[model samples]
Target chain A: MRWEGRAWVFGDNVDTDQIIPGRYLRRVSYDELGRYAMTGADPEFPEKVREGDILVAGRNFGCGSSREQAVMALQQAGIACVVAESFARIFYRNALNRGLPTVEAREDPTEIVEDGERVVVDLDELVLRSESGEVPLREPPEFARRAWREGGLLELARRNPERPPWR
Target chain B: MATVVERFLSEKCGERVEAGDVAVVEPDVIMLHDGSGATALRTLRELGTERVKRPDRVVLIFDHSVPPSSVEAANRQNELLAFARRHGIERVHVDEGVCHQILVERGYARPGRVIFGGDSHTPTAGGVAALGFGFGGTDMAFTLLYGELWLRVPRTIRVHVTGDLGPGVTAKDLALTIVGELGAGYADYAVLEYTGLPERLPVGDRMCLCNLATEAGAKSAYVPPAEGPERLRPGDADETVELDASEVEPVVSVPDAVDRVRPVGDVQGEEITRVFVGSCTNGRYRDIRAFTEALDALGGPDPNVRIVVVPASRRVLLRLARDGTLERLIELGASVAPPGCGPCLGEHLGVLGDDDVCVSTANRNFPGRMGSVEADIYLASPLTAAVAAARGELADPREELPRTALERVSGS
Candidate 1:
């Protein structure tokens, strides 16, 4: 699985409030969440995002709230993938559940990939490529790759509904 | 070494498991609140499966909007009831104060058991030595139907807490202090096992620490079953840190961030508009009883301050009512919201207005958590909040309370 997009840089500890504030949680609609995505941090973020755009940030991206709406907001906002120094556990798993690819860069991906630079993420090879160079990141397990490639856990479950979530 | 998380996973997998190994395990309980319950059900429809494999293990509650904040909120709650009925989910708690507390009060959080919930503070169940934590929508949806979910084993981070809790210093204060010193998210994706516990520590205080484990970016927190919880064994930890809690005193996490903690004296005179004394983090019967005692000593909260008391569950609220503790809060001019999340989520009930600065016992203080985006939220222990409410500003909980008050409140 490969994704290539322009990078959008965010800072460390981008909490769910910054992703989508709690006040907006009242909507409970993924589509509503997208229009307001990242508006908490930068009001113009939603307008600026394009389909297949990438988010690259520092450590602890998605650090607060298990809202899961945060991940949905990003997905609906057309964020292709999130590459960070590290991700909070819930956000990481939630992204996978939503079929949003999140790759952890052991080193600062920001230092290697600049904002607005075109980067390619090869999930199969676990490599992130930009004008700077190719950075080797850890690959997710086979099932995680399939989940993202297959659109997300919802689709995966829909396809296999007998017992659901076949191992 | 296997932490409790690791031990639980290792046992489930019948193989050695360590931190960072991804494994799937069945949870003993899956709790959903009004906020996530509606979404989880929607996911079921999306997945085209109206039935869950283990309806008996699924628990639903209406804590996010107890009485319903609006017609939309009420309708959403009604839909949840219909879904519960359709799915044959019988262990539903519509009047419960919060999911985490009711899970415990109802005896669902068995020691050494793994539990999942929709809210992040689900770690509150860890106070009982259970591997209780939370996840998001698809995960919750998948877990409900499949009875299993994936998790990466987290390395155990042992926080050895020593020294007697000082006058008016609470486990909430200690939790804030840890986040302040270590920085928020210090325990990112790690299990925080509390050791060197003072024998006198009460269950309420232990729950307070575990509940805020989410604030510290912990995957979960535990007090070790040896702390008095039955039917569990303490798991080995990989790393350890020592904390000299001897000098710990009343502290508050200043507005906008749960980790931005400072000594209460630093902001003693900060103007206050509200003081909330309840949430799953600090809304147990003991917590209510202690804060009421403090409010009684203060002759009631400052007339200008609005105090909102939320019980963690109907069980706790009933006990408080029977014991007249609820009456004491109302007598102190506190408006007691029904058993539920209340203003903690900020959708309704005691929502802060523009520029409102509130000292609350809820977990998060992220922008707009309790109401207006412009409002400021300070997280404090119920005792600290009680004192601050009485004086109408941020103040030390121990400023006037005698040492006996602390001892009596910390009773085992």
Candidate 2:
């Protein structure tokens, strides 16, 4: 799978609370949640973000809280993929479980990719291309790759009704 | 040569496994609280599973929005209760306490058991030698449906501590120091196994250390097996770090970043509007008793500050009441809330107003955590929070606590 979009850059330790605050957690619907995505970090983010944009961030992206709503909010806001220097483990797992592609760039994407610059993410080749340069990405594990290919764990589970994929 | 977590997971899975290996295993207990239970139930329905595979292993607790902070919250909790009733899941707690505290108090998180909860602080179970961690809603739903989940066996980081904490310094201070040194992401995808802890350290203090490992990005934290059939010692780990407790000083996590810690003297005299002494991090009975004893020695809280105290569990509250600590706190101008999470998540009960500054004993000081985004929060020990309440500003507890009072509070 591949994605091409404009880049939205964030700094290190952009925690789950910054992605979506607890006040908006009462509403589970993605559309309602999308309107407030990243508002904690920048109030104008929701209004300025366009559909199919890619997020470039520094180390430890999604660092706080285990709320999956953070992932859902980003997806609802039309973010095509997230490329970071590193990711908090739970958020990385949640994003993959929900079929949202995440790449851990070999170099810090925030240092190379400028906001609003055009970028391309090629999961098959594990590379990210931006105007400045091309950055290598770590390949996800086989199970995670399969989850992304199947459009998430839910879809994969549906395809195999008798038992879960891991089982 | 297996670490504590590896041994626990291997036993549960009935196979030998090590770091980086993926295995499907069943947990002895599955915990869901108000914050995540509703979402998990909805996902279960969407997955077309009506009956949970092991209702007997599930424990549901409503502590996030106890007494229903809003109509929407009320409806959601009601839905969870109804679902629990239908599934015949008998272990349900409402308005009892924080889910992690209740899990330990009820003995559900036994030594060497694998436990799963819906909140990130589920690692608190490791205080008792259990391997516990958080799962997302959909993952939890899937586990409920199939009674098992796959996990990558995490590498372990062993933290060895020696010596004793100095006067007026508590476990919270030590936790903050470790987190500050490790940085927020140093332990990502790893388990922290604490060894060489003071032999007489209280369970509450152990829980405090384990609880804050999440801030360092650890999947879970563990100490050596305290009791049970298994008597295990610290074994092979990916890395090791050492901490000398005697050299530690009272510290605080400055506003908005938990890993941004500094000595109490650096931020002393910063005026605060409120003081909160509760949460899963430091709401145990001993924490409250320390606060109460310090406050009594200081005469009382300042008239200009608002102080709120909440116990970690119903049992804690009952103990405080029976021991007369609750009455003394109320007499000293504290507004005690129920035995649940109060304003820690900014949900209800003591949410801060715009521009408010608070000294809190709870973990996490992210923006908007306890209230308005404009508000500032400093994470400190209960003793430090009590001193801040007395002075209406940050002050070193060491200077304020008389030596006799300090000795009594520290149980020296």
Candidate number achieving the greatest lDDT relative to the actual structure? 2
Fnat of all models, as shown: 0.58, 0.44
Which tens-of-lDDT digit does each residue in B303-370 have in candidate 1? 78888888888888899999988887777788988988888877778888987999988888877778
Predicted candidate 1, C-alpha RMSD? 2.8
Candidates 1 onward: DockQ, in order: 0.54, 0.60
- Clashing pairs in model 2, backbone N/Cα/C closer than 3 A: none
Residue B195 of model 1: what lDDT? 74
Residue-wise lDDT of candidate 2 within A50-152, one digit each (tens)?
8999999989999887888888899989998899999998888778778888889888878778888999999888899999889899887777778877878
List ranges where model 1 is wrong by over 4 Å.
A1-7, A109-142, A163-166, B14-16, B198-200, B227-231, B402-404, B410-412
Tell me the lDDT of candidate 1. Answer: 0.81
Question: lDDT score, residue B1, model 2?
Answer: 78
Candidate 2 RMSD to the real structure: 1.6
